[model samples]
Target chain A: MTNRWGLPHLGYGVGLRTVHYAEILSRWPAVDFFEAITENFLDTGGRPLHILDRVAERYPVVLHGVSLSIGSTDPLDLDYLAKVNRLARRVKARWVTDHLCWTGVAGKNVHDLLPLPYTEGVLAHVARRLRTVMDFLERPVFLENPSTYLQFTQSTMTEPEFLSELCERAGTGLLLDVNNVYVSAVNHGFDPVSYIDALPRGRVVQYHLAGHTDKGTHVLDTHSTRPRDEVWDLYAHAVERLGEAATLYEWDEDIPDFATVHAEALKARGLAAGIHREEVAVA
Target chain B: MPEPLTLDLVERWMQTVLVHPESAEAGIQSSPARALIDPGRVSEVVLASGHLTVAERLGIYQEMYLLRMRDALESDYPNLARHLGPHRFWHFVSDYVEAHPSRSYTLNRLGDHVPAFAATWGKRKERGLISDLSRLELALTRVFDAPEDPPVSPEALARLTPEASTELRLSPVAAFALERVRSASLRLLDSPEREVVPREAVPGSRHVHVLFVRKGGQVSRRTLEGAEGHLLEALTSGIPLGRALTRLGRRHRTTRPCEVESWFREWVEEGVFSAASLDPDP
Candidate 1:
């Protein structure tokens, strides 16, 4: 009974940001949909929402939140969730997603998507919490693998195995971060493609592609550069397995321009198109 | 390795990564092409070694992120930025971010606590002028970003007889509030060019009234006093046109009517309101 995403394919998308706001509106770019940061439009009856309203009229919008902090031991932030949920309905968003990590505890926000150890009890904890949240949202939550710098010595499960289990238990979807795969594989020393193959095809409902920083040993998910060739290969591998979900090209810091980000997104679309054509050829 | 106690190990790992990055070791082998390090031993162990330590590079993120955020606050609130000057403003921001790294995901909501932060920090005399400047700056954006409302327009006003004038309802965009504070605060804000007046006590000055509104999707801020501001506040907040006028007249009977008339007309031109909320006859 689990559907993947807004089907008939949303093609490829880019994180619609303020820098490219003028460009997208002025030209009505060729993107199938724009992924908006839900927090940006929430409580914004202002110009941000003004432009968002116009964009929503033309294209599908997906609401992504950073502060939902659903994993926190703290009681689900009901007020924050309600606000974002209302805005999601406002823009008719496709799906909502947040990281598979805790943001804070004891009512203080630590900001970073800190890692959670892969273990049986922790899986139970996450599954129970996500079930509560998904029930409240009344929709499938797409939990993403974070670009992690560290791991727990106590972890008994491979990251992929743990993720696979969570999807089964919570009945949620996965927004696989290919760049995070490359980043984590390199940072933790593993085969990125192997990690991709381990994911349950049914769970991966979306895909995120972005660039990261390699300042030597650790790779930072800065999303400030073009997606590296290695990450692109991993993305291709993911498409072969996960098929085409809602693929997004994310360029946050040092964002070049609308044209550049759009073109990058086009590359993902081209890849997806290739996948579709290949699927048709086989069919 | 012993299986980490489920929740206990997860919390420990999170605490380790949340505070620092170089913790944990995992099963993956280091591929120069792939790039992730040993996730097992990194617990309290950063991978950056040779050229720059993890501390050094991560320091760059910590510094730049903090500066980038502080720069946003400074740019948005010029008067406050000027008051704090360059070094002192950053000093406070650096300290503040370290004390309270943002919990929220969006950069848009990062500075909501800034005004309150300023009140506490400025009162401590760390970087004075933070509270008012933060408030004024926030007011500007709040006014600009506030939802638009329909108001009683000129045509509606024209139909009102002198008898109806007693209930002169304010337009939605006609919002103004008087915030009195010690010293000559707002005079420094307005000018063809405000000469940088050094921070010092302004002797004998009392409170100053403030104005706030969004015009054409941008915040418009200024100063207003007494009856006019009260008259406008009343009308926009749902008082009828007749009652608002009576309130204004009672408060400012001493002032000449013509001056108040010109002020009201100027606000109308600023895209303040569409028309009053409630009306009759028309």
Candidate 2:
């Protein structure tokens, strides 16, 4: 928490959306900071920027971009990355993050986070690219574990091993997505608790809590509803491992009112408190 | 040596799978190695633990591939969406996404292809939804993001004579646009409560005109008069001050300057231009 960048040691937060902009700014709710979708404010020169400007006055802003496609082979889309860097600097983001999965390549964005084969070679590629991204931004970035649907036969590393190596090698931090771990583990058939155990505990700087759809055979990271009980259990484990850091309750789809999302944020705050108290006991 | 594919390479192929159904089957085997039914185990990784039936799980990757993008576009281009109706709209969004997934990191950039893609659909043309409604929404998006250029000040105006006003330079933000049509149906998109609005009716009027705007953080529209639409077209195409005035001579030519003066004042206050170019060629 001492070395935490733009958004350091911030308790619990929520993703900023237009629907909740007024509530965040006017009500000045009892929250730490707000995590904004980087894409919403990027390239927008008018009111959205003005809104971000207002929101920034009240709280810290962290950048989360889905299109970074950091895992894509598309040569780092430097232009877009540069824009992200500029925007992050403008708002003084604590730390920006994108998915460990690829968004798109070959000049198209499929708008979904597809998992990569966890192999030594892939890890090396990510390490190299992540270093370049951090260098470009002039600040360390956090890579989140994507809630993925498919797995490759060629993968050699487990999700935890890959993420730990990613942070340890690239000199980056981890944005442990508790919901993604829960969703992916359930969908793929593994132990969620074990996945948490394997996480890069020390390097984790933040956590994202969100709701997902239970599609029977597989779970989808829909981010449209309230966090489920099972996700809460996983989050408690995340807090226990990573301690108190910046956490976001991501409700991107069917986003409820500010109060609804805030209610969820309070749930995360309560969990985070328990985890912090436990850490003190352990220490 | 069977070198492994990078995340970048997989992301590239994943891009293909969204549009090229062929990639869906290419990446992984058809049948899952094991059957998965439990939803409670949300954090476990079955594949990492050696479950190979990962392909079926990845199918969500395919379904969401279309669903997420379709949702993005429908929010902005409801008129075009309504024009296509649910079935045809889904077809267009699906087909367009397959060919052109969003490349920008922003959701604002997702519908960039709808306008161009509409050129290919016959239903889009017949319905007049693609070009017209698409143009309206896209312009609204641009206006929403356009730099905040306060309209020209009253002093900047009071200082100018009729002759000077004619040659004055203008910023691109004071944009004016129209589709080559005769119907007013496009206005349906401007309504505040968009979800319940009826989408289509028999075509009437040979052409239509409307104004697109972004104010106070929300995008809206206004119907433009014939003269105003003409004036806006003149401005958007980089026409100089006098030339634009001349183009609008049919309505109220620069000869009088009074009528044109009022119009320019209104446009300036609308946050249309960042500033008028002092040296715009006459």
Candidate 3:
């Protein structure tokens, strides 16, 4: 399931975090690709960006942003967009991605990925904005389904439906976060497998596997530890369906050594291997 | 027909609820959120899950807002947080965000106003010291994110002829900042082992000039006084070298012109200048 741009699958990777900088530079681990939080690197011209330049020189890198606020009603932040675009080009990111959520409006940033209502009106608004963003960026934008805790009654469709429809209308790509799918499904009392199946096949260009704190009743996507067993199970299912795409493991809080996070990211290889075996069986 | 829940209204309601300094209930009832959707109809706007009501779910976002802001600010001002202790630091952060919520996309800029805000943070005994520390940390943060321009080479400094001093233009290194801070706060922050202690335990609120520079990929500070600080400020202010030296000479009759040349050599060796050009245009 190649994307419209035919971006290659860079295989299993881990987010390039600051905690792991010294180890990454010293050991130069054999991770396939490194996903950087674009906003963290954008405004800094210091050590973090310095490390990113060195890391980009060695391996494939992709830019995942949080502050794009794609669904917000306020006028688009052209300065932020220009910075993101310039950074993607500066780092030679394979493709740029942000969340399918709004961060804030009214010229103020809440800095959290707030949920969006899934309706025809909102869909058309977001799709038009996404197209404008992609045109300015001069590349197809990829959006990930964020882990949402609340749903709007005004929402007319499920998140998966909204995502598929938006991707189709906007002519963008998808970075399906399996963990978020599971988190949102569990919170919303929907079937995660069904949600995955509903996604547009060729539109998904990447995958994010991360840990979440399941607070018995509601799940929080904290990205603080290794992905749970259920999340890994979901990743296996995702690889089976999505076939080939770049996969990244995220551990933003209480992050351990590079070896620890890298080891967790390496677990995706088993899932990718399972896909190959299933392909052989189908043949 | 009642106005449909347009994207604008939905965003306004959610942002209002999420950014309220108090509970989400207060946010939903605020005039802005209420204007978008009736306070009684919050459930109709934001659907509730089995375990949590709409307000409680909104509480989740409301709760995380300050925590995220604190985390970013803590990264920028760890020494300040350490000095203030955990509980006081959290209080300070809560008050700080309310006064100046993030207007920029990057969290790096969220603490841009902390130094000034700390200065006005309640009339406390340690207010001046805390403000000084915060100002120092803010300078470090700015220097860290400042544009990365390589320092002028020693060879460039060596090539400067005394006759060319009148036309010489020196541009401060991109990752360089000047701060006037209390000597006591400077010592405490510079110490490797930092801890919260009584305000009186540290001495010297007397003013001191400090030069912050990013060299070898680390932000470091140097103490400066008198002509050193003045000459550097002059160079940074676009005053040519000869005129700057003349000003320093006029101000300090006891200071030798030889000292100014030494300071220039020292600044160049310290990688304080990004570019040095002879300015006929200026």
> What is the C-alpha DockQ of each candidate?
0.26, 0.43, 0.78
Q: For residues B106-212, what per-residue lDDT tens digits would candidate 1 score against the true structure?
A: 55555667767777774475433457556655665555455655444567656767765654554454332234443355543532221222223334345544666
Clashes of each: 41, 29, 0
Write down the lDDT that model 1 would get.
0.68
Q: Mind giving the per-residue lDDT tens digits that candidate 3 earns over A1-283? A: 3456878878889998877888899999999999999998888888889899999999999999999899999888999999998999888998899999999888899899998989998899899999999999999889999999899998889888899889889987789998999889989999999898887777779989898998887999999978888888888877777666888999988988888888887778877887888899999
Clashes of 3: 0
Candidate 2 RMSD computed on C-alpha atoms after optimal superposition onto the true structure = 5.6
Q: Which stretches of candidate 3 lie over 4 Å from their true place?
A: B1-3, B190-203
Name the weakest run of 10 consecutive residues (lDDT summed) in model 2 chain B. Answer: B33-42
* Best model per TM-score: 3
Q: Tell me how many residue pairs clash in candidate 1.
A: 41
What DockQ class does candidate 2 belong to?
A: acceptable
- Models ranked on DockQ: 3, 2, 1
Cα RMSD for candidates in order: 7.6, 5.6, 3.1
- Model 3 pairs in collision: none
TM-score of each: 0.78, 0.86, 0.94
Q: Which of the predicted structures, 2 or 3, would earn the higher DockQ when compared with the native?
A: 3
Off by over 4 Å in 2: A4-7, A278-283, B1-14, B21-55, B124-129, B174-181, B191-204, B215-220, B250-258, B278-282
> Candidates sorted by lDDT, descending order?
3, 2, 1
Tens-digit per-residue lDDT, A1-283, candidate 2 = 3644544577778888877766777788877788988878888787778988877877888888877777767788888888998888888887788888777667666766767878898888889998998898888888889987766756787899899888889877888888999888876778999998887566778889988987666677888888899999888877776666778888887878888888888888887777777778989
